[model samples]
Target: MTDLLLNHRVEGSASAPPLLLGPSLGTSYALWDAVAPELSIGHRVVRWDLPGHGGSAADLIGPGASVGDLAGLVLRLADSLGVARFAYAGVSLGGAVGLHLAVHHPDRVASLAVICSSAHFNGAKPWQERAALVRAEGLAGLAEGANSRWFTAGFTVQRLVQDHREADPEAYAACCDALAAFDLRDRLTEISAPTLLIAGREDPATPPVHLREIADAVPGAALLELPGASHLAPVQCPEAVLTALRTHFDGAAPRGMEVRREVLGDTHVDRAQARQTPFTARFQDFISRYAWGEIWTDPTLSRRERSMITLTALVAHGHYDELAMHVRAARRNGLTPEEIGAVLLQTAVYCGVPAANSAFATAQRVLAEEED
Candidate 1:
């Protein structure tokens, strides 16, 4: 391991919770320029440049490096800053480092957010080829095409492109070697940190499906997909990325909103938010913080079990409208239609036939809508 420290910029009050932001390959911490200041309002935000990418030493890592090596450097940097545990967010290769840390060093990561990154990076053959090309011809060619890979067709961040062009070729190649060797797909289920994933719908490099794969494996993980974004989401859609990060790493209400969106789905939650009034706002906040955040987020009960209990309670009270909504949630929690029917059938014996009858009708309608 290299003893040289990574170059970093710290923001916000030192007393606040520490948040470490990592950059993607070819770009520096400057990639977070649009969003870091706002994040620093409530967090001790530390943005770091990758070795050879910005102000960090090019020799910090050699050609045979791995994502674990990058994560080690980040842990060392955090240790130097007296940050024992922190909320971490990263883009692309930087995101891979976050994944490695969450899997191998869970005690050091309080929470994790992976933006436009994947667990395996498509099996590494492509990264190996890119590493070879960069080693031989340098970053100019890649920088020329950076706009295409990192953003949508007519939306380029000049500073980021220039950072790509100016990156140290040997160090960049070493990063590529790390990417070529990185694969955390099998270890995703082992993550214990509260996790969030943001994906650029337009990103061809590591698309939304990549984020979805991680969300599927990590228990209670949440995902947000940006419509106009590509690989460098924070640069391309700062407001959207900032909002997601805030909700993921902030107070109990924000945490509740994230879990609400995850379990009920975005469309349902968005509609609820839109319909909230001044009189209802407090109630909404209470539900988010108390019911969704504190209750639903409790890991002691699997979401599937919660769905079962919620379904039974709703039926017992003859809350068919709420039952319909939870029917969809039960499906999302991995309950088969037959299993849902079984749950309702059991409820009939205790909740009474009339109540179960209404619930079965509501559930049937909801399940049919899902099939369509």
Candidate 2:
């Protein structure tokens, strides 16, 4: 609320786990418009504008600022909101701020996702030159080329372009100064929080290799690359960006999806998603959130046990087609072919010979497919 804090909007339940979102330079928190709402369902989403962007005071940052300074401002905003440790995700410059926080103030970040950003902004000379250009002539020139720099050809988000156009010249230049001085390459390995890196394959500002470098350096870090996307991925490919963030942050349906893919394999899950229609979308969500998310993800029973139970239930109900799928899943869960036969035999004794006969035929077909 104070001038010292960055301007931010909060969504979702106050009691939910806190998630902080940061914006790239030349844009406002509105950059998250397409993705934040869905993310807020399971998180206390706080999306902020940089100094002089959106509703933030232009004086929050001045000339010769560092990314560290921007990070400090973000900390102030989080502290003012009574948030201690939070999951963080950011784009470009905002991502740089997250890297700084993860490196310098590890205690405050629970997990991190960096999108279209780098550990070192490709050295300081280009940023220094950009700072000078903005300070001398302002942001008009940059705004004019915003779409090309930020998104793929024939795609545009006018609000972001306008945000670039309206950004305060001095503050924007100060942000450039921050980028000029920023370099966290050596400290990347110091990041202890769980990290994820997202890259737009076509991004000119920071390419996929930048993200790969961080993924290689940070212990247990993961990377995702979205094809056909440019620098501003959330604006250009919100669904992919949102899915990445949600999976990293443990959103309910996304968590289920992760489990679903693990249990069923990517080929099957991808096919299911590809065939999804509006009428079936809710049903799919239900399966992900409940069947996979809650039931399958439960640690109380081993996946092997669940797979056995699933096979019995499908056979008992005479769902032969689904029985084939569960047969495949059973194999994935490490059940031996003989063990699967035992489960089917038990089902025959309890349910009926006719149902079990059909189930065995289906399982035999799926098992043969796997062998092939």
Among these predictions, the greatest TM-score belongs to: 2
Question: Which portions of model 1 show Cα errors greater than 4 Å?
Answer: 254-372
What residue pairs are clashing in model 1? none
Error of 2 at 310 (Å): 12
Per-residue error for 340 in candidate 2, Å, reads 18
lDDT of each: 0.92, 0.91
Per-residue alpha-carbon lDDT of candidate 1 for residues 105-215, written as tens digits (9 for 90 to 100): 999999999999999888778888999999999999989999899999989888889999999999999999999998888899999999999999999999999999999
TM-score of 1: 0.69
Off by over 4 Å in 2: 251-269, 275-286, 291-372
TM-score of each: 0.69, 0.76
lDDT, residue 186, model 1: 89
